[model samples]
Target: MLGRFRRKQGANTQTGVQEQDIGVSNSVEQQGEKPALHVHMPGFNHNGHKVTRGIKPDGESGRGGIHPWHFIRICFRSTSHISMIVNVLWPFVPAAIVIHFARPDLHLWNFILNYIAMVPTANLVGFAGQELARKLPKVFGILLETFLGGIVEIVLFMVLLHNDVNNNLVPVIRAAILGSILANLLLCLGFCFFAGGLLREEQEFDEVISEVGHGLLLMAGFGLLIPTAFYASLRGSIDDALLESKTLNISRITSVILLVAFFIYVYFQMRTHHGLYDSVLEKDEERDRDRHEDLKKAKLTLTECVFALALALTCVSLHAVFLVEEIDYIVTKRGVPDAFMGLILVPLVEKAAEHLTAVDEAWDNQMNFALAHILGATIQTALFNSSLVVIVGWGLDKAMDLNFEVFNIVILIMSIIVVGNFLRDQKSNYLEGSLCILIYVLIAIASWYYPNPAAGTSNTAEGAGTKAGG
Candidate 1:
C-alpha cells in the first residue's frame, strides 16, 4: 500500500505542473485528469483530450499592447499625411461656391491679379528668414529673418507709397499695421500656444524665445507710451504748426531720429540678453566636429527651394494686396468695421491655414523650432511690417499720418496687455485661451460701434511717425 501511494503522488505532482503550464482547469486535476474535463490551448492538452495546433482560446488577442505615445504618434503622422488636401480644398471650394452663387461685381480675375502682385512680395520678405534659417543655424536664422523681413517690407512700402492707385497713404499704412498686428497676436501666438498644449504634456519654451517675447512686450509698452505722450503734447498746445504739411519734412526728420534711437535700444538689449556669437559659433563647431564628411554634400535641391519660395511668395503677395482690398471692401462696403476686420476676420482668414504648419511641427515634437517660427513671424509682422507701412505711406505722395481711431487705440492697448501677460506667464492653459479669445471679441465689438476721429482728436501714430521720420 505504501509503494502504490508513493507512485500515485509522483504521478499527481507531474500532472499538476503540466496542467499549470497548459492553463488547465483545477476541476480537471481534481477529477484525476479526466479527458472530458480537459481544455486545450493550441497543441497542448490535459489528460487524453485531443488539442488542435494553431488554435487560440476565445477572446485572446493576437496583437500585443501598444504604448500610448506610440498610438498618439501614429495618429499625428496619419493626420499630417492628409492635411494638404484639406488645406487646398477647404478655402478654394467654399470661395468658388460663394462666388458662383453670390455673383458679385468683384471679378475674380482682377482680384487674382492684384493678389498675385502684392501678396507674393510680402511672402518673399517672410521667406527670406526661412532661407536664412535653412542655410544658417537656428538663432541667427531668426535674427536674419527679422532684419531682412524689415528691409523687404521697407523697400516694398517705398515702392507702393509712390504708386498712383487710390493714392491714399493713410489707409494703406493703417491697413498694413492692422494686418501685421492682427496676424502676430491672433494667429501666430494663438496657434503656437494651442498646438503646444495639445502635442506636449507640458511645453516649455527656450530662454532665447523667452527673451524675444520679453523684448516684444517692452516694445508694445513703449508703443502705447508714445501715443500717450502725443496726446499730452497736442492737448497742451505744444506746436500748432507741428502737424501741418509745412512741417512735413521736419516731421519726417523727427520720425527718423526717434526710430533710430528705439532701434539702438533694442539692439543693445538683444545683444545683452542673447550673446551675439553663440549661434554662429555653435554651427561652426558642429560642422568642424562632424564625423560623416559625406553628409555635407546633402542639401535641398535648388529647384525644390525655388518652388517653395515661389509658392510662398505667391500666397503672401495675394495676402498683402488682394486680401487687403477684399477686407477693406468687405468692411467699407459690406458693413464690417476696421476693428472687427483687424481683430477677428483678418486673424481668422490669414492665420487659420498657417496654424496647420505649427500643429504639424508640434505633433512631431519639434517644439523649439515651431515656437521660434511662430514667435519670430509675429515679431516680424509687428516691428517690420507695421514700420514699413508707415515709412512707405510717407513716400507715396504724402505722409499717411495714421490716426488710430479710439477703437484701434483700445484694441492695441488690450492686445499688448493680454499678450504681455500671456508671455510673462508662458504657461498657457485653456483659461488663458478663453480670455484671449474674449479680449479679441470685445475689441472687435468696440471697434465696430466706436465713432471715427472727432474734432480736435489726437493723431498718435502720425506723431510718432513724424518723430521717427525726422
Candidate 2:
C-alpha cells in the first residue's frame, strides 16, 4: 500500500510540471503576436524602451516631417536671397580694391568703382526705407518713403555744392535736380504705365489724387521758372556779383515758400483728403489680401528695422563720400559734360532702386501704388528736396541758384504739359506709356549731345586742382 501511494504522488508532480510549461509557451506566443502600444505623449514606452511619440524607432518622424534646420537650409538656398547676397558682396570687392590701390590719375577706374559701390548702397537704402514704411500708416509710410528715397540725391548735391571750388558745379547740380523731376515724371511714370497696361488692357487711379499732384507739380515748375525768368531779364544788365546776390535772395525766399507749400500739400494728402488717394477696388482688395499676409510675415521687428536703417544709411553715406570726392576727376577725365553727368548718371545712381520698386508695383498691376510712388517722388524732388538744397546752399554760402538754363526750363515746362495731358483723365494705356517713354528717350539723347562750352574750362581747372592734391 506504501509503494502504490508514492507512485501516485510522482504522477501528480509530473502533471503539474507539464501544465506550467504549457502556460509559459502560450504567454510567449501571445506576446509575439501583440502590436506595439503607441502613446501620443513625447515620452512613451515601446516594448521596454522609451521612445518619442511622433518619432519612429530610428529617431525620424513619419512621412511629411520637416526638421527646423532643414527648413532654414532650404530658405538660405533660395534664388532671391542668393541673388541679393551676391549683389551686396560683389560690388564691395571692386570698391575696396579701388580705395586701396587706385590713384587720382585713374579717374575712369575710380568712377566705375564708385558707381558700382553706390548701386548696392542705394539698394540698401531703399530696402531700409521699405522696412520702415511697413511699420507706419499708409499715408505716413508713403511720405516717409518719399523722403528717404530723395535723401541720397539731396546729400550728393550738398556735397557737390559744398566742394565746388570754382562755382562750376552749380549748373550740374541744377541739371541733376531737373533730371530727377523729369525722371520721376517721364521715365518712372511712363514705365509704370507701360508695365501695368501690358499686363492689363487699361489701368485707372484716383483722378483727384492725380490732379492734386499735378497741381503741386505745376506750382513747383512755376516757382522754378521765377528764378530763371529773373535771370533772363537781368542777364545783360546786372554785374556777376550783384546778380549772384539777387539770385541768393530769390532762392532763399522761394525755398521758404516751397517749404510752406510742401507742408500744406502733405497736410492735404495725409490729413484732409486721405480718402481721395486710396483707389483700391474689390478685386484689388482680394488680391492684396494675400499680399498683406505676405507683408505681415516679412515684417521686421522695430529694433531690427531701426538697426537695418542705421546700417544702410552708414554704408550709403560712406559710398556717397567716395562718389563725391571722385566726381570731378571723373568729369575731367571722361571729357563728359557735367550737365550730362548730372542729367543722366547722377540721377540714375540715386534713383535706380526706387525706379525698380515703381516698375515692380506696376508689373503687379498695383497701378495706384505705382502712380502714387512716381508722383510723390516727383513732388518731393520739386518742392521738398530741391528747396532744401537751396536753403542749405544759402546757409553754407554756396552759390546754388534756381536760375536753370533755358534748356532745363523748357524741358520742365514740356514735361508738365505732357504729363498733365496724360493724367487729366487718370487713365493710362500702353500707347500713352510708349509716347512718354519716347519723349524721355529723345530728351536723354539730346542731353547726351548738348554742348557746354564752360564745362571744358571748368574741367581743366578741376584737373589742375586734382593734380595738385595728388
Candidate 3:
C-alpha cells in the first residue's frame, strides 16, 4: 500500500529545492540565449561523447562537459557542506608543531594534538587534489583523484611500517588496516545512509556502483582470508617459527597480486566502464538549479591548488609521524588496548572527518557519489593500502602480512558481509543505517577489551609478527 502511494506521488523522484528550478526561465532563457558558461565549456557530440567540433561547445550533440567554470564552481563549495570542523581545525595544525618541539615528552598531548591536526590537513590535501583534477580532462581527472585519494592512509601506513623496525608494531598496523576498513564500511557508510534518510524516507543509489564496489571488496576480503587460513591450518601442525616463515612468504606473494588487481580495477573504473559513473553527470546540474548558484565560482587557481597540496602533504606527513611515534606509549603506558587504539581511535581521527562528503551527497539524494565515496575509500584501504604496507614491510624487513589476529579477521570479514547485506537492495533508510552504527559501537566495546597478544603467544601478529618475520 505504501509502495503504491509512493509510486503515485513520485516519491523516488529528486525532491526538495528543485521544483522552483523547473518550468521557469531566467533572463538568458527569456532571450533563448545560452548561459555564459555554455559558450566556453566543452560540449558532448551526437551519441553523447565529449568532443570539440567547431564552436558548438561540443562536437554536435550540444551538451556541456567540464570547463574552467567547474574549477571556480567547486572552489566556492562551503566547507560546511563537507565538514563542520575543518574550518576550526587549522589552529591544531600549527599547535602540532609547537607540541612536538617544545614538549615531546608529553606523549598524550603529542598524540592528541597530531591526531586532531590530521583533519584540516587531510581536507587541504583532498580539496587541493580535487582542484587540480578539475583542470584536466574529466575522465582522467576522476581517475587521478580516485587512484590517489587516500593520501592520509598511505602516509600513516608508511609511518607505522617504517617505525616497526623492532617488529613490535605490526599488530597495531594490522589492526589499523582492518579498523580503517570498518570505519569506511560501517561508520562512514552508516552515517551517509542515516543522514540522507533523515531528509528522504528512502534513498536509492546507482546499483551498478554499489555492485562493482562490493564485488571488489569481497574479492579483497577473500584474498586476505587465504593468508589467515593458511596460518591457521599449519599453526597446529608445524613449528611456530616455520609456520611464520611460510605465512610471511604467502602474504608477500598475495600482496603483489592484490596490487596488480587494484590497478586493474582502477582501469575498469576510469576507462572501460567509465559510463557506469554517469551518476556524477547529474550532480552539477542539480546544484546549478539552486537560486544562489550564479554567484558561485571557485576561489583557487590551478597553481594555487598545486601549492596548497604540496604544503598540505608536508604537514600531513609530519603529523602522521608524530601520531605514530606515540602509539607505544599510549598502548603500554596508558593501559589502552592496542586493538582499541587502532580499531577505533586511529581510524576515527583519520577517516571519520574526511568522509563527510559522502554524508553530504546522501543528504542531497546523490547516493551514487555518496556510495562510491564510502566503498571506494574502503576498497583502497583493504586492497591497495594494506597490500602496500605488506610489500613495504618486505623492503624494510618488517613482518607485515595479512594474517591479522583471528578475532580481527573475523570481525572484518563479518563487517563486510553485514554491510554488503544492507546494500544488496540498492536502497537504504535511517533505521538500517542506525543499525550499522550500533554494530560499530558494539565492535568498539569489544576492541576496548581485546587483549594485546602477549609475549610468546600462539598469535602470528606481534609475538606472532616477530616469529612470522623470522
Q: lDDT (CA) for every model shown?
A: 0.46, 0.69, 0.74
What would the per-residue lDDT of candidate 3 be over residues 95-172, giving only the tens digit for each residue?
Answer: 988989999989999989998898777777766655455455544554555445587888888998888856777877
Over 1-470, each residue of candidate 1 has an lDDT whose tens digit, in order, gives 99999999999999989978566556666778854545545532222223323322211112234444533232223224434333333244335334533754664543343333332233333433343344443455556555544443443344435542443334334544554565556555665566556644555445555566557645743553354345444553555445444334543444454456456645653566445435533433243322132122222222333444455444454344434445334534455544454444444444433344444554454445555556555555555455445555576545544344444555565676667677665456434544665665565666567433323444433332211121
Q: Provide TM-scores for the models.
A: 0.58, 0.76, 0.80
Sorted by TM-score (best first), the order is 3, 2, 1
Candidate 2 local lDDT, 1-470, one digit each (tens): 99999999899999989898778767877888543444454353223334434333322122233344543332222112422553555457356446635575665666677677766666656665665574465667778877787878877887777777656566678889999988888888888889888878988776665788899999999998898777667765757557657866897899899989999999998898776554342234344423543332323334444555576566666666667777776666555665577787888878866776677677666677777778888898899888888888878877667877678788998999899999998789888889988998898888878766442132121222222122
lDDT of 1: 0.46
Estimate the TM-score for candidate 1.
0.58
Clashing pairs in 2: none
> In candidate 3, residue 364 scores what lDDT?
68
- Models ranked on lDDT: 3, 2, 1
Off by over 4 Å in 1: 1-104, 107-132, 144-169, 175-179, 199-201, 224-241, 244-300, 318-320, 323-331, 342-355, 362-367, 451-470
What is residue 124's positional error in candidate 2, in angstroms? 1.9
Candidate of highest TM-score: 3
Candidate 2 lDDT score relative to the true structure: 0.69
